[model samples]
Target: MEAAGCSYQFRIALLGDAGVGKTSLLRCYVTGAQGAAEPDPEPTVGVEFYSRALQLPAGLRVKLQLWDTAGQECFRCITRSFYRNMVGVLLVFDVTNRESFEHIQAWHQEVVSTQGPDKVVFLLVGHKCDLSTRCVSSQEAEELAASLGMGFMETSAKSNCNVDLAFNTVTSAIEQALQQGDI
Candidate 1:
C-alpha cells in the first residue's frame, strides 16, 4: 500500500532452508555491510524486518520491508502467518549446498499454497556465489527458474556480487505488480 508523502511500501520475505545466507543477503542489501562468516548464528526465532527505500524506474520511491524468517521447523507457524502479507518472496539457496537448492521447490509450493499465486512475486537466488566450491550449477538454477516461471540470479553477500541487483530486481517486479494492481 502507499505510504505517506508519495512512497509505496512493499513487504518482501526471504525464504529457504536453514543456513542459506538469508541473513547475510539481508544485511548486505539493507545495511550495506558484509555479514560475518558464522554458522547458524542462532536460528532465527521469529520474523525480523528491515526497511530500505529504493527509487524505481518511473521515479517511484518504494520502501521495501525485507522480512527474514526463521528457517527452522518450529518457527514455520510464525513464518507461515506472515506469508499472506508478502508481496515478494526471495527463494534463496546456498550455492555451496545442493540440498538447499533442491528444497526450493518445496518452499515455492508452500508459498503458493499459503499465499496464492498472483499476489506474490517469486525470485530464485543462489547465495554464496563467491565460494569456489559451488555445489549447484548455474544451469540448474536457470532451469528451475524457467520451470517455475520465476527470475533467477546468483549473489555473494561477501563479495557483494549481484546482491543489489537481486534485491532491485525483486523490487522492480513488485513495483510493476503494484502498478498493475496485482498486489
Candidate 2:
C-alpha cells in the first residue's frame, strides 16, 4: 500500500530469539528518527507495526512498514503469516546472549525457507553494543554475515547507536535489488 507523499513502501521484519532487543531497536529507530521521546524496551506479545518515512541519500522517499516480530517460539505461526509481503528482514541477535547469536543461522533458514533467498534482502544485526558483557565479537558477527552473504551491523537501542543505519542499509539493499530485478 502506498502512503501519501511516499515514493515506496516496504514491509520489513525484525526476527530473532526472544529478549534479543528487536522491539527495542525498532522503537528506538522510529521514535529517534521522528524526534520523539525514546521509550524503554518492552517484550512484544505477538507482533507490532511501526511506520517511518525515510528519505534516502539517493533521493528516493521510502515509507518503511517496520514489523517488530515476537521472537518466542509460540508466535512462529503468527509471524510466519506476515512473511508474504515482506521485502526485507533484520536478522537481529543480542551480543550478550550466546544462544541468540548461535541461532542466527536457524533464524535465517526459517526466513529463507519461507520467503526464499531471492525474495527478500537481509541484514544481520548484533544488538546491545552498550552492554559490557559482550559474548559475540564484532569479528565473529562479521564473519557469519559474510558467510551468509548479508551485511552486518552492531546497534545499541539504549545508547541509540546505529539503529537507523541498520534499517536504512537494509532498505537500500532491498531497493537496489528490486531495481536490478533480483527481488
Candidate 3:
C-alpha cells in the first residue's frame, strides 16, 4: 500500500526448516555485512520482523516488511498467522541438509493453504551455498521451484551470496503482480 506519494509497501515472509539461515539472509540483505550466521545461531522462537526501503527497477521506492518465521513445529501456529498478510515469500532451504530441502513442499503448502496460492509470490532460496557438502543440488532445487511455479536462487548467508538478489527477485515479482492486479 502507498505510505505517501510515490512510495509503496509490501509484506514479505521468509520460511523454511529450522537453521536454514533465514535470519542470516535477512541480515546480509539489509546490512550488507556477512557472518550473520553464527556457529550456534539461536533458533527463531516465533516471528521476527524486519524492514527496509528499496528503489525498484521501475524507479519506485518500496518498503519491504520482512517477516522471519520460526521453523519448529511448536511455533507453526504462531507463524502460520503471519502468512495471510504477506504478498511475497522466500521459501528457503539449507543446501547442506536434504531434509530441509525436502521440507520446502510442506512449507509452501502451509503458506498456500493459509494465504491463498495466487495472492502471494513465491521464491525458492537455497541457502548455505558456501558449505562444501551440498546435499540439494541446484538442478533438484530448480526442478522443485519450477513444479511449484516459483523462481529459484542459491545464496550463502555467511558469504552474502545472492542475498540482495534473492530479496530483489521476490520484490520484483511482487511489483509485477501489482501491475497486473494479481495481489
Candidate 4:
C-alpha cells in the first residue's frame, strides 16, 4: 500500500558484494526489529524489496522503495536491470571482509555507467560494524567515501546501530538534491 499522505517516493538500492548484510539492513530498518529471524540469512536471490514511509522533521513525507539486490556474481545481470530508475544507492560492504570492500568500486562504476542523467546520489556504507575484527578500517572506508564524492557511514543492522541514521542521511540528501535540481 502507498503511504497515505506521502508526497514523494524514492527508489533506493543496496549494492555490494554477497553476504554484505544488505537484506539485514533493509529488514532492520523497515521492520524496526532485529535484522533477521534466523541468525544467518540465505542471501537474497535476485532482488528483494521493502518499503517504509518516512516523515522527515521538515514535514516532508516520502515512501522509500528499498531494493535489496543480490550481490553474487551470477546474479549481477539480474540486479543491474533495476538500477535504471534508482534515485539513490547505498554502496555497502562488510567491514570484516576485505574483498567485499574492494569490490565496491566496481559496483559503484556499474551504477554510474548504467544510471545516467538521473543524477543518483551515492553513499558508501561499511556494514557489520558490530564485528570486532575488521579487515577494512574506518579510515580506509572514509578515504574511499571521500574519493567517491559521497558520504560514508558505518552501521550494524544486527545491533540496530546507525541504521536509521544511514538511511535518513541518504534519503535527506536525495530530497535536498531533488529540491535543488541537483538530481
Candidate 5:
C-alpha cells in the first residue's frame, strides 16, 4: 500500500546474472531484516515484485515499485518484457564473480534497447561486496559506470551495507528527472 500522502510513483528493475544477489538485496531493503527466517532462495523463475514507500527529506513522498527479474539466460525473454515501463534500473553484478561483471554491458544494452536509451536512469551495482576475494574492483566498476553515463555503487545484502544508499541514490536521480521534466 502507498503511504498516506505519497504523491509520486516510480518503477525500478533489478537486472543481472543469476546469483548476483538481486533477490537478497531486495529482501534486505524491503524487510529491513536479512536473515530472520530467511528460506533457501531458489532461482527466480521470471519476475517478482516488492515495494516500499519512501518519504524523502524534501517532503516528496514516492512509492517505489521494484521489479526483481530472473538472471538466468533462459528467462531473459520474460524479464525483458517488464523493462518497458521502468524509470530506473539497477544493473547488478557480483563483486566476487568476474564473469558476471563481464556481462554487464550486454545487460545494459538489453535494457536500453528495450526501454529506449534515454528513457531510464541506470545505476551500476556491484553486489556481494562483503566477500573477501573480489574479482571486480571498485575502480573497474566506476570506470564502466562512467563510460555508460551511469552511477556506480557497491552493496552487500548479506551485511546490509550500502543497501539503503544504493536505492536512495537511484530514487533521488529519478525524482530529479521528474522535477526537471526529464522522465
Candidate 6:
C-alpha cells in the first residue's frame, strides 16, 4: 500500500494538572478501550510513552508518540523538558474540576514557550465528560480555547466519547501545518 511507504513520526504531549485524565485518555486512544473502572487513577511518577500508527486524511501513515506526563508539581521540571520535542499537545482538563480547567493556561504557556509559537499545534480538551456530577459547561471550555488560540473539545475516556476525534483532530492540524511549511 502507498501508505506503507509514507510514514511520518510525530510526538505529542499530554499536559494538565494531576488527575485530569491524561493517562486515561492515552490508554483509551492507544488501546481502543477504557481504563480500569476505578475511583482513582494511580499517579504517573514520570513520563510514559505510547505508540500508535494512524492513517492521516491523505493516506499518509503517521506514527504518534503520545507522551503522558506526571502532572504533580514536583515533576514540572522533568515534564517541561519534554515539551520542546512535541509537535502538538493535548492540554487536558477535568470537566468536573474547575481548577484543572483553569490551569490550562499554564500548560499552554509551557508548551508554547518550549516548542516555540510557530511550531506547536494545541488542542484544549475537557476530559471526564462521563461524570455528570462534575460537568463544567462547554461554553467555559470553548472560551478558554478561544482565548488561548487553540481548538477545543470535551471528551470522556470512560465513554470513549470524542477521544479518538481529539487526537485525530490535533494530528490533522499538525499535518496541515507541516504541509503549509508552518511547522
TM-score of every candidate: 0.92, 0.93, 0.94, 0.96, 0.95, 0.93
Query: Candidates' lDDT values, in order?
Result: 0.88, 0.89, 0.90, 0.92, 0.92, 0.88
- lDDT of model number 2: 0.89
User: Model 5, 48-154: lDDT tens per residue?
Assistant: 99999999878899999999999999998899999998999999999999999999999999988887888898999999888999998999999999999999999
Q: 120-153, model 1: which lDDT tens digit per residue?
A: 9999999998899999999999999999999999
Evaluate residue 77 in candidate 4 and report its C-alpha lDDT on the 0 to 100 scale: 92
Candidate 3 wrongly placed segments (more than 4 Å): 1-6, 36-40
Clashing residue pairs for model 5: none
Worst 10 residues of 6 by lDDT: 1-10
- The backbone clash count of each candidate, in order, is 0, 0, 0, 0, 0, 1
The sequence of per-residue lDDT tens digits that candidate 6 reaches over residues 8-123 is: 88999999999999988999898888754635668998899888888887988888889999999999999988887689999999999998887889888877777788789999
Tell me the TM-score of model 3: 0.94
Which lDDT value does model 3 have at 114?
A: 84
lDDT of 2 at 127: 92
lDDT of 1: 0.88
lDDT per residue for candidate 3 within 34-56, as digits (tens), equals 87445645888999988888888
Clashing residue pairs in candidate 6 are 96-134
